[model samples]
Target: MTETFQISPEQAEMYEAKYVPAIFAQWAPLLLDAAHVTTGQRVLDVACGTGILARSAADRVGPSGAVTGLDLNEGMLTVARRLAPDVEWRHGDAADLPFEPDSYDAVLCQSGLMFFPDPDQTLREMRRVCRPGGTVGVQVYASLGSQPAYGPWVELVARHAGPEATRLLSTYWAHGDLDELGRRFDTAGLVVEDVHTRLGTVRWASADEMVQVEIEGSPLIDRISDAQYTAIRNESRELLGEYRTDTGLQAPIGAHLVIARQR
Candidate 1:
């Protein structure tokens, strides 16, 4: 079943301040490289949370290249605009992008595709905005089977929240498997050119730090009451203790970056 999508100002700011930094550090470079952003290309960043990838694309494109970041949350776009005033930030949805067909030279989405209620429709929107031969790159987290840092969180949420939690915890979209991505590309009238994985570690100073990050930014927290939230926190702390190392509290995070071209 598809869950409703809503991003309030508080939720958006909480996510930007609490979780986006680490995520940006992890995926921005890989996404930029995959998109092959150049000096004079027009680019669009869909679901551009906190404008990490969008801002990075703006820098890559320089003054000549134009970057437009579209997101449903005004709070996120507010932060994005302040962070990268040079780039245009617009309020829009992934399923219905507010741009003309063949408007961009490349489109980039980092860690955002999985959250769309209609992944296929979102891809179609991305495809519509891309000029023929232009690239559309998507970055999504791989399965929890490979990402230990996220698995424990998923387990805790599922235990407390029930089956619907799968929609929140899993990639929901066809991001983890190449065949699935290929099929999505074909359905969206695009050609899948490359599929690659990147390995990264999300480091927290301690379990407490990680817990605070999730509590403030995660949808799991939004769904739970104060009591359940406390219980989940305690349980997460207990589970995360095993991964603590001298450098810091580090855990493996993996993502798949897929590049497709408009056919």
Candidate 2:
């Protein structure tokens, strides 16, 4: 059977309600600030999952500026629409964006490029939609080596939940090379600009809750067996014990913030 990567409504709901606020929301302002987005500037957020960045961009741009969010998954778009009904949310792919050239003042993608099938095409599309001197920004997770907690998680998952489960969960850290990222921007004809390395923190209620929501909201749901889950859960409980804090499990998540100008 073909592996399923897209998420369902239930998974989207879980991700938006739990994972987004805890992890993804912190990086939105970084992209906006780097892009130097101002009021009355039209912006497009590509692969806008649940509109976290789109909602932030909407607020930053004010009512005068337009904000449109595009995503390949209907489930994610559904959650995004519900969050910002006023903001335009469209269903579309990143590689083949349905927009005219020189259409927007700024184009942004947050933690979305790593998931696209053809990131070069996606970057070119992001550049194409942006006008001359317009801004385009991309955000993706840092290397797995930097995040020590994830290394163990992957190992534990491999030992319990299977290697495919580990691979599915490791997708976020796919685009970790800064040099390669800059090359993509250059290849897309976007002018080189500032690149920022940001450290963000994600604090969850507990390790159990963290892994529970991840397993539920992730594409690994149907792929893993119940026995595997039990094993992983038992093993993870012991493994993640070190990460627990007095308040919650506080983990440092690093991201690369790249800002490019459309030429």
Candidate 3:
């Protein structure tokens, strides 16, 4: 069966409330730093996903600079607009950006490249809109194997929830190969300036919360059955014991941040 990657407004809200703090927000500053975004520079955050990176970019660029966030999902854009009324949030596809050539000083896509049907074309769009001497940065999760906790969680879900659910869960870390990612950027005519990994901690209040976000905060919400959810939660209590702390469940999550320039 074909799997859908989209999330609903409710899911998007939960994502902003739960997943962002636990994960995506941590990478926002790092990605902006890698892109060297600064004051008085126009920035475009493609696939902005509730506008975490866009809002962060806004802070970096200040009032003089402009930031526009674009994404295909209206659900995500809706929540994004509510959070930051000042930023320009547009509904558009990443593969075909509705913007003029050389429209931005910096283009960013954080943790969104993996879901694009045509990441190469999307990168080309990013490069196209970026003016000369500007930067383009994209961040993606490293391979599931490299992730200390999630790899095993994926395995547990696969064994209990079956392959379709596993497939959907794996989409975030689908393109972990640095060489391949670099090649995609090169094909889009962007020079690869740097490609490196950044490590961060993913902490959950409890095993149930960890499993809860895995389902509720993503498209996997409706796909997983009650039994499957229960099984994963029960298994995680013991399976992920080593990574637990007095505070919660903490694990080292690594993601690759790639900074490129228009050729």
Q: Specify the highest-TM-score model's number.
A: 3
TM-score against native, each model = 0.83, 0.86, 0.88
Backbone clash pairs for candidate 2 read none
Candidate 2 residue-wise lDDT, 94-184, digit = tens: 8888899999999999988877878899899999999999999988998776766777777787777667776778778888888888888
The worst-scoring run of ten residues by lDDT in candidate 3 lies at 1-10
* Residue 239 alpha-carbon offset, candidate 2, angstroms: 3.9
Model 3 per-residue lDDT tens digits across residues 1-263: 11235778998999899889987899999999999999999999999989999999999999999999998888998999999999999988898899999999999999888878788989999999999889999999998888878888888888887777767788778878888888998899999998879888897898888888777756777877888788888998898888889998887788999999887
Candidate 2, which ten residues in sequence have the lowest lDDT sum? 1-10
Task: Give the Å shift of residue 253 in candidate 2.
Answer: 1.3
Off by over 4 Å in 3: 1-10, 161-166, 215-230
Q: Which stretches of candidate 1 lie over 4 Å from their true place?
A: 1-14, 152-168, 171-174, 209-239, 245-248
lDDT of 1 by residue, 1-263 (tens): 23446666677777777567655556887888887888988999998877888888888888888999998877788777777888899988889899999999998898888778788998998999999999999988777656666766777767877766656555532377667767887899888888888877777878778777655555666777888767777788788887789976876777888999988
Query: How does candidate 1 fare on TM-score?
Result: 0.83
- How badly does each model clash, as a count of residue pairs? 0, 0, 0
Instruction: For model 1, give the 10-residue run with minimal summed lDDT.
Output: 165-174
Q: Alpha-carbon error at 211 in model 1, in Å?
A: 4.2
